[model samples]
Every structure is written in C-alpha cells, then in structure tokens.
Target chain A: MPTTDADTTFRFLGCSEIQEILGKQAVDERQLAELLEEVPLDSVYYHTHSYFLRSRFIERTYPNDFAQWVAQQLQDHVLAERLSVVDPFDFQSLEALREELISLIDDHLSGMRTVPRATFGTPFYFNRSRILEVPTGIEVQTLREFRDAISDVDSSAIYFHVFEAHLRLQREENDFSAWFRGSLKLPDLADRMKALNPYLGSLERLRSNMLTMCDEQLAKSGRG
Target chain B: MIRELEQYREVAPKGTIDFLYRLSDLVQDKRFLHISAVRYGGGMVEILRRIVPIMKAMGIEARWEVIAGTQEFTDVTRRITDGLQGREETITNEMYQTYLDVNARNAKVLNLDADLVFVHDPQPAALVDHRKGGKWVWRCHLDAGLPHRPVWSLFRRHVLKYDAAVFSLPGFAQRLPIPKFLLYPSIDPLTEKNRELSRAEITQVLDQFGIARGKPILLQVASFDRFKDQIGTIRAYRMAKKHHHCQLVLAGSGVAHDPEGEAVLAEVQQAAENDPDIHILQLPPEADREINALQRGATIVVQKALKEGFGVSVSEAMWKGKPVIGGTAGGVSTQIVDEATGFIVHSVEGAAFRIRYLLSNPSVMSRMGAMAKEHVRRNFLITRHLSDYFTILKILSSE
Candidate 1:
C-alpha cells in the first residue's frame, strides 16, 4: 500500500445519541405543523436524521419520523410519501428543512375536509437528541488504511461521518469525501464516495459500499 | 458474580463495549447514585444489581441505595403506583402524606450528594425535595402515559423538581416540565435467567416440575398480577389446548412490595381449575436457573398482558430462541416484531390463534425464534442499555 499524504491524518470520530422528550405532543397534523415551527432546530434535525439509529434493519418504509407518524398514526399514506421524499441533505440548514416540513403539512391540510387525529395515547411526541462524540483512536493517512478502518470501526462512527457531519453540521461534504479530496487530493475518488447514498440501507451496507469504492480506487492506482 | 466487559465481546456488537469504555472515560470522576424502593424483587433492583458493579469496574464510583419503609408505607406507595398506571385505587389525603413522610425520612438518612442521582419510580421521587446538590433524575419505569389525573397532579410537583426524567418508552411519559429521556429497559443475557442452557439441563428442570417434554410447552412466566392478565392467559391456553396437545406452564413468584400478587394468584388458580395440563408453579424469586430452563424448554412463550413495562420476561424467553406471543401493551410490542420475531395479540382469542398458528407450522416457529433471539441480541441486551445510561450521565455531568 502507498500513502498519498503521510502528513495529514483522518481521525475517525464516533457518536452515540441520547434522545430527550421535548414535552410537546401533537395529535393532529395541524398541531404537528405548529410545533415544527416553534420547536428547536435540534428537534427538527432529530426527527429527520435519526431514523437510522432507531432501526438497524435494511428495509424502512419511511425515511423520517414525521413521515412515519403521518403514515401510521394519521393513516395518510399520500402525505407520508410526499414528506418522505423531502431529503434533509438537500437543505443547507435544519431551519430550511423545518420550513419544508411545515409547508408539506399545510399543503396537505388545505386539501382535506377534516384534519386527522392520532389515536388516543399515541400522539407524535416531539423529541430532540444529544450526540456525544467519542474518539475512536483510529487515524489513517492512506486510502487503504481508511478502507480497513471502515470495516473495523463502530457503526455509530460510520453514522457520525456519513449522516451527522454531512447533514447536521452542514458540511460541504461528508467527512470521508472531504478527507479524500483535501488530504490525498483524489477529487475523483472523493466524488465517487460522495455518490454513495446514506438513506438507502443500514449503516453496515453504507460501510461496505464505501469500502468497495476504496478497493476500486486502490486497484486502479496499483496499490492492490 | 461480576463479569468483565471483555466477557460480553462475543455477545455484544463489535466495538460496542469499547464505545462504552470511551463514554465512561469522559465521566470517570463523577459519582453516580441510584435510589430505588427495595433491595429485592422487581426489574429496577435487578438492573441496578448488575449495572452498578459494571460501572464500578469501568472506574466510575457508582452506588445503589434502597429506601426503607414500613408495611403501611408500602401499602400507601403501592396505591400511588397503581394509580399512576390508571388503576382506580382509592388514595386518600392520609395515604399521600404517608408516602411523603416515608420519602422524607429516607431522604434524611440516604446520601443525596452525587454528581448524578437517579430516583427510581414514584416511591422515592419525592426525595428530590431534599436534594443537596447535583442533577436529580426521576427514572419512571411504569406505563404512565395515561395516568390517573389526580395521582399525576399530586406527583407532577415532585417530578418538576428533578433536573430531568427518564422513561422506558416515549409513550410511557407524561407532560413533564423537565427534559425526559427514553431508555429501553434491557435483559442481561449473561444472567442465569437469560443465559444459554443445555438441553439436558432444560429437560431435568422440566422433569422436576412434571412438565413433560414431548408436547409443545406454552409458557407464560410473569408475576400473577391482574394487569399481567394470567386469567386471560389461562383462557387462551385452554382455547389452544382444545386443538393441540400441549402443556401450559404459568410460573411466577410474588414480589415483596406488591400486595395484590397473592389474590391474583388465587384468581388465576381458580380460573385454571385443576387442569393437569395447566401447571401453576409459584416458585420463589431465586429460581432463576429453573426459569431459564423452562424458557429454553418452551416451544412458544406467551405474555398476553393487558398492561406492561418493557416486559423483561418476554425478552428473556426470546433470548432462549423462543418466539413470543405478546399483547400490545407498554413495550411488549416494541420488543416483539409482529410477523417477523413474534405476533402481537389484542385478545385471548388472538393469542390462542397465534399459538395454534405457530404450533401448526414448525418452520415458522424456528425461523421466528431465531429472529427473536437475534432481535434481543441487537437491541434489548444490557450493553445498549448501559450505553444509554453512560450517555445520560456524561451529559448530566458536563452540565
């Protein structure tokens, strides 16, 4: 294996989420939209992005909590489908994402005669998550080292670099892609890595896809 | 009896134990105090017994203290807890005063000085009034989302004093002014109740209890409480027994603090009515190994509860590679993935139908059982629970 840059090292950061109930409950889409306007930006970030942490499985019907609540509790699959397609990564900030969510609910409500309420005792309680970052002590300088670390690091570490850094922190790119382009100057490799979608599957599948790209890049560079 | 973090390496997810070590390192200097009602019985005590030692091993100063109370005090507190679960218990002004007096007396003797203090359930929640310093958390383990309005009004004042509150599920909490955290209660897979048992050991335990091995054993291991609905379970078993030749084993022991267990047991025994197939064994709380063997020997475990709180026994059975038929109570549905891990039933007839369905299809039973064990391994294990606690403590310590 050859190192492109021995001077710069990418430190793998891991994080665990502790969810806090915001003491706000919404029984109908009207209340949900109102709370979305008033709740903290952290609450907006959590309901949209923390779906991966909750379900470790490969298949998910809805990508975000708001969509899932609407589909299951409100029994409005049409609105859920519209809300599910609103990806957070497209928005530059959570505030923008929050506006999109409120807009979707308000639009859906205007077409309906009666607003649907959730069943008794099953309201969509608003919650916010606190992310606690812990250093994994793994630092890599080469693409091969990064590839090996991805296989060995915790899933939460993968989540931190892929979802949290890219979306929540409003980074220009994910930690892996940014490290690839900046440290190693492999812009092609970095763009290919950025193409790997985080919302398609579980974290394990994401790691595998990232590792495959590294392997392909290494093979072309004669580092295989 | 404490095991090292290294011992759970094969059982836990890769790097999970290491993640806990790193999180614990962040708050190694903080002192954690856990206050509950009793030293014996119940799920909270069982968790503290295992979690405290492991926290100490990780170099955190963790201590557990129980609030000692009189029999009268226990009776009054029981009413309070029952009322919190939406049961129509007659809690007079005198009973409420007794509950506070007991907590006040215990607060004077116990050390309320720690970096983070966890007061378990409503019995010791009022102790937040006497807090000297540090962050106090009211860790409510009940399905308290729809609590009796009067009981919640009396209890909400004490909860408002705490810095934060923790509940087993998001739906299991009330509108508290303080920040509330949702942490799922966990089962220690390394414990005797959940550990792997050999086939010979399982058979011997079954023989001792006169529960024959050939037929599929329909087992429901829960305390004989009305909310647990052992009577409904018996009816379900009887309905299923009409079709399949099976043995129904309802095994449980009374907790010291719960006074209704004996009466519930009597009603359950009467419902069962000397049926040779319905083996009602009221074993003591120390019968962990026997319970483990019974769960392992079971073909399909049933937890048809009308109400529950995280359902540890359901997880324990699932850990032993048994698919469960659970009711849509507090967290039972959360544990059992419908149609994947097990079926969630709404009534006794639904429970019977699922039991019959599982019995008729052998491959689905095995497949669901394997999925159930894997599900528990990934989510309901102690390691995940510990990570949640460390995350809470780290945040509280820094604040």
Candidate 2:
C-alpha cells in the first residue's frame, strides 16, 4: 500500500512565462560571447528553454538563442551547428553552459580571419523571463493516478515537473522520479523516469515516455 | 451578454481555461481598469469587450472605460498617432495644449482608483498626470519605434510616470527606463470572423463577391492605406501570375470617408487596370462573415505591409489554416515562422518568389498551412493573451 502522507502526493504545477528585456544588447558574436559571461542565469535559461514553451508547432533549426542568432543574423552556419549541439541538460549548472558557450565562440573566433557581426537593426538583445507557477488542481497519490494525470494535464505541467523541477529546484532527479522512489518505494521505476531526457524532443514526447514508464511499473507490480 | 470563463473551454487550448481559473484566483480581489480612446469601432475595443467580461467571470474585478475628447482633441491625437508611426504630421503648440486639456477633463470624470490602471495608446496617456495612486501601466499599440523627436520628447514625459509599459513587439517599443513587455495582439477564435464555416457558406460568400472559383486564391485583407502597400501586392501578384494561374483578392473596409484611403484605393485600382483575376472588395465595416469566408476559401494569404502595428488580419488568416506570406514589419515576421508556418518576405520580389514557390508545391503549401494554424493556436489566440495578462497581473500583485 502507498503511504498516506500529504507530502508524498505529487502536486502538478504549470508555468506561464513573462519575458522581460534586460537592456543588454549584442551586435556581434564577440559581443554576444562577452555579454553571455555577464547576463543573469535567468536570461540564459530563458533563451534555451523558453523556446520549448513558446513554440510548440515548428521544430527549431538551432535550439538556443546564441546558435539561432549566429546562424540567422551573422550567417555563421559552422558556429551555429557547433553551438546547437551543446545541450543544456549536459551541464550541471547554467554557469557551466555559459562557459561552454563562451569557449566555443572563442574557438570559432580564433579560426576566423575577420570578425562577423549582425546587421545594424538585428542585434541580439538579452532577455529574461519570470515564470509563474500555477497548480494544476490534480494531485496523484498512486501510479495509476499519476498516469491518468499525465494524460490530463497541460504540456506546461509536464515541462514544470520534468525540466524545471530537475534544473531550477536542483533536485537530483525530476519530481516524478523523486516521488516514485522516496514515497512509492519504487527505485526501478524512478531509475526509468530519470533516464528519460526532455531535451531530446517535445514535451508531448516526454509525457508519453513518462506515462509508458508508469504503465509498465503498474503492470509489473500487478497494481494497474 | 458577458461570456463566462467556462464558455472558452471548448475553443481554448487544453488546460488553458483551467490554468486561467487558477491564476485568476490569486487576484480576485484586485481592481483592473482599462482606459482607452473609444468604446467601439477599433481592435482595442473589441478585445476589451471580450477580455473584461472573461476576466470578471474568472472572478477578477475588471472594468473598461473610454476617455471623451473634442474634435480638436481628436485631431491632435490623430496627428500624435501618425507621428508615432513615423508619418509626417504637423503638431502645433495649440494641438498639444488641446490634447492635455481634453485628458485633464476626462481624468476628472473617469475613476482612477483601481489597483491596476492600464492607459492604452496616446489618446488617454496623459491621464497618468492625474493618477491618484496605484500601479499604472502605459500600453502603446502603435509602431512607435521611430517617432518625431519633438512630439516624442513631449509625450515621453507622461510615459515616464508609468510603473511599466506594454507593446505588441520589441521593435515597436520605445527606449524607456521603465520595464517593457512584448505581448502580441490576438484574434478571438470564437468570434464570427474566426469561427469555422461550412464549405457551402464559404462558396456562397465567394460567389457573392464575384470571386471566381477553380483557381488558387491569394488573398490580402487590409485597410486601404499607403502603409499596407496594396499596389505593391498587386505588382507581386502580376509577377507571380506569369507562370501560375492564380487570382488575387484585396478585401478591406473604411475607404469611403478618408481621402488618403480613397487615394490608395484608386492607386490599387489603377494597378489592377480592370484585370479580371484581381478582385478588389470594398466591404463594409460589419462584413465579418464575408471576411471570414474569404479567408477560409483562400488557398494562400498574403500580408505584405511596408509597416504595421501587429497585423491582426495575419493572425485571422493563419487561424483559418492558410499559409501567409508576410512582410518584415511590426509583428508580421513575429507571427509567421518564416518558411515553417509561412514565409517572411522583405520586398515585392521576395513576396512574389514565395507565392510562386508555394503555388508550385501543393504539399509544402498544405504543410505550411497546417503549421500556421497550429502556430496561431499556440501563440495568437485570445486564451494566450489572457494568460499573458494574468501572468503580468500576478507578477505586479506580488511586487
């Protein structure tokens, strides 16, 4: 039987983003690299992760703002391709991701004979977002309820529990995995949930994977 | 009749209505007052009509008011609006005094005691000078990127008093010390102009307009204004028509009274030169169903505006599953994903090239159309607009 503790129940939270301009502008790659070092971590997070929230229709060619600016504005496809491959989930902190971005730009700058810049009007402006978390009004105490809630909640809810809980909360694992292991006493299920990466695809795909994991666990334990 | 928040559950994206309920619960006690120039006949009024009731239904104390102005006040405000949009307009000292006098007169009558007051556009902007107390926000709906320095310098002093400002696009926002937010204007999906139409109804409206069938329809729905560049659109259509057999529909209203609108309409007519394929529709302002039918029946939509203030027609067409070839103005480029949902063109040649390319590839056209509808669903819907406002309100309440 599952524990009846209130803390053990998973409260699904969804987020809405309010983008704010930070007044930091960069006209070139070197300028961008320099600003990247000084911008708040929220700006970095906003550029990399907010794309998933804002655009759910088209797949982005370059995932991050830095890569997209270089590719579209500066026309540096080589640098863009390199920057696109540096996934934010691979780094422990946004600071680490910032360093990796600056280093890559520096290396690309060294190989080039002349510096490249965007047009006068199309400079990259640094922005940050304030994320307001709203409760989904659905709490799940069992794996079956979790699976049902996963299908019912919004994509923002999935993004919150998986991505934001992992990075912003600095949890060792996502909220679902942590809940499953600590409360449900299911280490194997937690491991399965932890291995799934949200950065690989859309939030819909991540929700499907999480549901599949929950279904498998329920079936294996004969509780579904 | 005011719509209940639950009524939007059918049209809104999944969980959005519920999310709004949750967000609204946080600020049910606060008062939100929206003050603008007119109570009717504009996009701002239409939005306020829907959102105020919806916000009230969500349990927020939301109300809307319009500022009263004299003929001189109206003339001065019009010139100020044109000046903000980078148009050449003369604003004398008397006009500035008239604008302030009208605002001061209206501020005395209107209630300025709300916890959050949203003073929209330049007409009622100076009402902040009479702000009793509360967090005031200036909402500019024009393309105010490059304004006349003297006018901006005078008007900008009033804007400085606001706690924050909201604009439709980053490029449209002026450089102010206060925080600025970019919130794209949205189209109500449940409205008569955006509701789903039957095939027979669409055919009836098209046939009623004398627009022929069996040819690819490239439509641009905009007012008869120089900034809309209807002549340029006709030129692009002519260039594309050499290889592909297509018809161009330029449908709009509000050309009867305004002299400039009449001149632009005449210029467009001259460019068309009685071409049978080009359909120039002088629709009445209340022809929402016809516009909806035209958009639905169109194979591709074009909005090649040289300048715009967040083209709502672009979103209207995109909502009907049409691939839009938009220009890099106001929020056209922001709405169209550029080769994904639709194509973003810079010039007449660019618009013509994309129109030809899409006409040649039917599969790409359908794909882009599907993506365009989804993009509008995600970004430009009334639900998302409310969500943004609630987010801002929640943030400000906390502060």
Candidate 3:
C-alpha cells in the first residue's frame, strides 16, 4: 500500500486493505459506476482515502443500494448491516465511519485461519509465545489489540526499545532485518520484515498488518 | 525609610505621596518576599531596588531573593522570554525539565513564608508550585497576549497554580482561572537614571562620548533585544534623516541572565555600520547616570520596540521632558498618547514621520514634552507603583 502525503489535508486510510480495495476495484460495481459518474476519478481520491471520499461514499452509497450490494456481492452481511444504520448526513465525523469500516475488516480477517500481514512493506510474524506474554490483561488477537498494546507502552520505553534494537542491528549492516534478527532474536523472520518500509504505510495499517501476521503465525503453530 | 519618601512631595503631587502613606498605614508591618531571576540589571531589578527600600520604610518587612541557575538554564529562559514577547521559538521537553529543576532547587533553599510572595517573570514563575503558605502573585513583565504556543502551555500549567497573576498592561495578560491585576511598571524618578542633571554634567557626559551638540539627537535607550527592535529604530532614524538632519543614538546594555543580548548587539552593530550619524553605544551595566545624561540631551527619544513590557525607557524619557515616539507594541502605547503626551507608531515609516514632525515644530515638541512629563508624574512614578502594590496587598490580606 502506498502512503498518502503527510499534509493534514490528506486523510490516511486506517487499513491498507481498504485503501487497496478503493484504489484497485470498488467493492460494489453499481455504486462505483454511480460515484465515477458523479465525481471525477482524481476528486474521488482527493488525497487517498480522504475525508471527502469517505463522506461522499457514505452519502452516495450507504443503506439501500451499496449496502445491499455489499451483502450480496461482497458477502459481508455484517458490514453491510453496519453501513446501513450509519446516516452519513447525521454522522459526527468522517473518522467514525472510517474506524467502523476498518474495525469490521479487522474483525473479519482475524477470524480466518490464514492472514497476510504486510504493513507499509514490512512483514510481521506472531506465535503463541508472544500473544501470551502481553503485559496488558487483554488478549492479543486482532489489529485493535496490537495497536492498543503499542499505545499502552510508555513513550520512553518505546524509545529505548527501538534504540536498543537499532544498536544491536548496527553490528551487521545496520538494517531492520539485522535488528529483528539480532535484537528481537527472530533470525528466520528478519529478511521478510526488513522488506517493509514504515514510511510507505500509515501507522494504523502497519499495526493492523502486524496483528494479522501474529494471528496467522500462532494458528500455523497450532497454539492460537 | 518613610521619611525618605517625603522628599518626593517636592516633585510629585501631594495627593500621590499622601495616598502612599495611607495605604502603607493599612499594611504596616506585613511581611513580603520578592523572588526574581537576578539582583542586578534589567528593569525588574531596578524597580525592586527602589521599591523594596521604600516598602521597608512604610513599615512593611520586605525582603528580596535572587534564584540561582546555570548558563544552560539562562539560555532556555532567554528563548522563553523571546517566545513570550511574540517571537517564534521552540522550547523542548528537556528545556522545560531544566527550568522546573532549577526552580525546584531554588524553592528548596529559599524561604518562601511571608504574608505575600511576589514571583517575578517566567524564570521564577514556577516557584508558586512549591510555595509554602503565602499569597503568590506571578508578576509577568512581558507581552503575554500571544506567546509561542508550546512555551505558553508549559508556563500556563505552572501559572494557573498561583493565587493571582500580575501583568504590566491589561492586554499583556492571558485568560486564567485565577484573578489577575493590571499593574504598570514604573521608573524611579529619584534614581541616578531619572534624577535632575546639571547642564554642565549633561554636556560633559555627551562630550566624553564624543557626541557633538551640533546635530539634534534622536535617542533610543533599551537593551539590544530582538523585541526591542533596535534595528527597526535605526531604520526609522535613517528614514527620518532623509528629511531631517538629526543624528540617532542607540545606547543600550545587556544583563547577565539574558543569553541573546550579545548576538542582538552584534546584529545591531552590523546594521549600524557605515552610518557616521548613528551612534550605537553598548553602555556598561552601571551606566545609569550616563543613560540619564543621554536621555536628557536628546531632542526626541524613540522606543520603537516590536514588542514591549511597559517600557520603562519610555517613562524614563518622558520624565525628563522629551517628546517620545514610541512603538505601539505593549504597554508603551499605554504611556504614549498619540498627539498628546507622545506619538505611538506602528511601523518604521510611521515612527519616521512622527520623528520628522516633532523635530520640525519645536513649540509642539516642547508642549508635548511638558505633557509627557506630566503623564509620567501622574502615572509612571515609583510612588504610584508602590501605592498600587499596597492596594493589592490590602486586598490579598483581607481575602
């Protein structure tokens, strides 16, 4: 997934999969055609997954037509019903709708046995060992849990963790791969994780991808 | 000490001195402690030196203490000072921690117990957070209308802890949960900087500096700070000189607590190069008598500061009976009444026009000078300042 410009005018898509779906093929054919007819392709993505796009999508496609299509064509009845209840005109903010959609996708993906976790471009792997060791009382399963865990960590601790990881990595070419291998002690996982560039992913997308990878790895190990 | 203030009756109105006496009678024997960043240099110190002595005279047991800090602490505070004066600057978390650490250390060693404790400026503002049973008033001496956001947010956290906050002008204050008072800073008319100077004494001081009596002088007396806009003063002087043949004198000195003074002084020097008529004199810290002579010898005094905190120099010049063209920045506008006491200008061009107009009409200048002197006498004298403090003290004690 490509990152949007960091300017405040550009709204970052919380989920990279959602961004990819929006960019490549609209989830609903009729809704996509109707939207394309009403707004220019460039304006539809004023700045990828912008508030304008979210508002327009909610206003033009929600409830009757797009929700039905999502239920029938996309086979996401739960998400379709959720979208049906959200009144775009009366909604509090664009972020509320975006979060609702992202959460729905996150819930659906975590339910699957196999998950692809690619954040920005980096890959993350999780197993039963990591999930059971979270300091927080909450169980680690979905993207939201991963994000919450990261947020729960103190800023100084995060700084030191990243610093220590980077320092050990410096002995061998000073890259994320080396750090993951040397500091995190995940030699087999280093090369795959190193491929991802955090600058190319929104913060939300990166965390979500990491969570998905953790879940998949745990499932593969038969300990999830 | 109270008898010494009686000498002011010869220069001030009878009601002013009597008011001080009455207020002092009400607050007699009350203990007050003033905490500031430095003991010498700057207007806060200058005012405290005179005011503390007189407060003691009035039967108020007043004491003054200076906070200790390292050079790094002073550097951080200098940036904060500039930020409060509407300059764009970044104050980091490290800087904030250092400032609080210094204040906390001082709080540990200093005796803060009194009927009232006055914490002057941002340097010692955090002392209120560590106060031990006293009415703490945060005396902010800078323009606080639009401080740089980060710096103001940090300062506001500590300032909100005070019982009350004091500002030089009503506009220089921030909206706070606590009660605030507008108290204008004053110049000591009896100090060496504002006392009567003999004709021979003034002439000799000017001659020592090689400032010839040939040209009419345009003077600015302030520290070489960016907010003071000494460069802007020079620019206005240059523009005025195109119309009038008057020479400009920029005389100022720096304080030890402010780290940016030397850089600003160097900038002023670079801007003043190649101008023979422009005199940039970096006076010593103790050049109060010389500053008095310079202001007394000037045809017109200008304080074209970009942002000011009740510029005492404006009051100092007005007290000497000189027509002042002051910047419409902070409390300077409060002292300078456009076309009445003195003219308030917003830009260099506006200041130049006023400077030229004042020099062209000597009678108008003389009349304005008289008005300026009367204005200072009525409002900006140390006696009035002392009386205001007494009034606040009375209210605080009653509460």
| TM-score per candidate | 0.90, 0.94, 0.59
Q: Which portions of model 2 miss their true places by more than 4 Å?
A: A1-7, B1-3, B88-90
lDDT of 1 by residue, A102-137 (tens): 999999999999998876325788889999988777
- Model 2: docking quality category: medium
DockQ, Cα level, model 2: 0.61
TM-score-wise, the better of 2 and 3 is 2
User: What lDDT would candidate 2 get against the real structure?
Assistant: 0.85
lDDT string, candidate 1, B9-124, tens digits: 88887878777787788879789999988887766687789889899988888999999999988998888898898877787888888988998999899988999999999888
In candidate 2, what are the lDDT values of residues B236-323, reduced to their tens digit? 9999999899999999896877998999999999999999999999999999999999999999999999878889889899889999
Q: In candidate 2, residue A164 scores what lDDT?
A: 79
Q: Candidate 2 vs. truth: CA RMSD?
A: 2.6
Task: List each candidate's DockQ score.
Answer: 0.52, 0.61, 0.01
Instruction: Provide i-RMS per model in Å.
Output: 2.1, 1.8, 30.9
Q: Which of 1 and 3 is the better model by DockQ?
A: 1
**Candidate 2 chain B lDDT trough over 10 residues, lowest sum:** B1-10
Per-candidate RMSD vs. true structure? Answer: 3.6, 2.6, 27.7
Off by over 4 Å in 3: A1-224, B70-76, B79-83, B86-98, B225-235, B254-275
Give the best candidate by TM-score.
Answer: 2
